[model samples]
Target: MKSLSVKLFCLLLVVLLTTPAVAEIVVEPEDITWTTDAGIVTFQIRFHNPDPTAWADEVSCTLYAQDFGVFLPNQNEIGTYDVPPIPPDSFFDVFMEIPFDQLPPPPEVHHPWDPMKVQPYCTPDDHWDGNVDLIWAGPGGAGTIDSHLGTLLVCPTYGASEIHVVTNCVINMTYTITGVCAGFTVQLVNEDYTAAPSPLAANWSGYIRVTADATVPIGTVCCFTVNFTCGGSTIPLILCAEACDCGPISNEDLDWGRVKSLYK
Candidate 1:
């Protein structure tokens, strides 16, 4: 029996070693924060493909605060996206935005800090005690999972120094628009973009809405995406639609900050 067990173990090891590593989707969560309650909270997340071959998978997320582990509207979950297949040994980025309407308002806590620089948003403190889960989905389907543990971050700026109330610099970050669904186009727009130099800082931030011809059932969702690159990182912003009356969905007001250039 012991010999049989050893043989089975060796067989499983050999099978795993010989197969492509695309079964698991790994996510490295970056600590992010927001100041206002008017818009959605965006999470800067890094996703890696550990597979030896290219892979595309279905991804979704849920958010809960530390002090308040609350349920979101319309079934307590956020958006769902099918990421385009990534090459072997490569990774990409995505900005997961959970709408303010679907989430609990940030607790009115007075204190906020990070290990890096203690800066502004000092009054904004919330926690991502929930998780992002990825399951590998290929041409048909595969069997495996990649799950990031609870992201417990309470209102850390990740070391932001200056407060950008107005706009100045326009060409700092690179933009890439990836089409998750059809018939919808997205653009980057900054109302105050100029050639003149200004000040301070802020990274990728935006909102997106989808429009399509197909009718999805009520309680179902469809999503689209647009991504940008800044400081050698590719971040995809995925926006979704919730079916209210089981009809074709429409677009919402998408406002983006102006940038210098856009690439594939």
Candidate 2:
């Protein structure tokens, strides 16, 4: 996901370069890793404040699962947390989880081993399964300073101004899509319908297992194309994950109670 985050950051810089006074926020692991057991999935996000000047006074941070147009619950901001002052030249990690069962199942479910359902999205088999986005927010405003590809320091370059600007900074985000049967093939397709291989492990036509490593920064929209091949042919699926601020529960996102309820 390191590469993915950097790619997204560069794109954000070009798109939002006109925005005034944007603080640079860098995230590592553009995609989060997920592991599934039975019906449970757990994951972690590793982050650091490389710039002592920018993140010095960052009093709080928030994590969120953004909505991707669909009513599916996966898009909601699941967690928001507060933290103490972090020393300069230091790093921090936040652990979070997403329960597959917590969100409604896709419109259709095809067993990983089911060859008949493998080609549902091809030609006459177009499917409309919904997708969701993921994001995290901290004390820094939406802007970033220049640095190496994988450096941990994100030095602050600007300050907040009267401008209600939206700067989408790039950071690393990694996630593991687990619980699917093993030995199947998983591919990530973008909004443009282009497909790429998923880094997760799983079998064909049994369940969907995929891991995506991308460079994603905050404030950008990301669409995923998930494909699993069971009987030689490929089946296509789509999901979207966005980057944004997931402040405290009171920030008025999708629903904090529902997110916490699943943890119980």
Leading candidate by TM-score: 2
Query: What does the lDDT read for residue 44 in candidate 2?
Result: 50
- Give one digit per residue, the lDDT tens place, for model 1 in 1-264: 999999999999999888764444565433223322345566554556677765645444333332121111122444444555566767666555676555433222111122122222122223332323333344424432221211111221111111111111233654444644343333333323222222123432222222333333333443434444445544443333333221221222011112111110
TM-score of each: 0.30, 0.33
For all candidates in order, the CA lDDT equals 0.35, 0.32
Estimate candidate 2's alpha-carbon lDDT, on a 0 to 1 scale: 0.32
> Mind sharing the TM-score for model 1?
0.30
Off by over 4 Å in 1: 1-23, 28-38, 52-75, 108-264
Candidate 2 residues 98-214, lDDT tens each? 565564332322111222221232112121222323343455533211110000001011100010001111222122332332222233333222342343223211122232222
Model 1, residue 4: what's the lDDT? 100
**Candidate 1's C-alpha lDDT?**
0.35
Model 2, position 168: C-alpha lDDT score = 17
Q: Pick the candidate with the highest lDDT.
A: 1
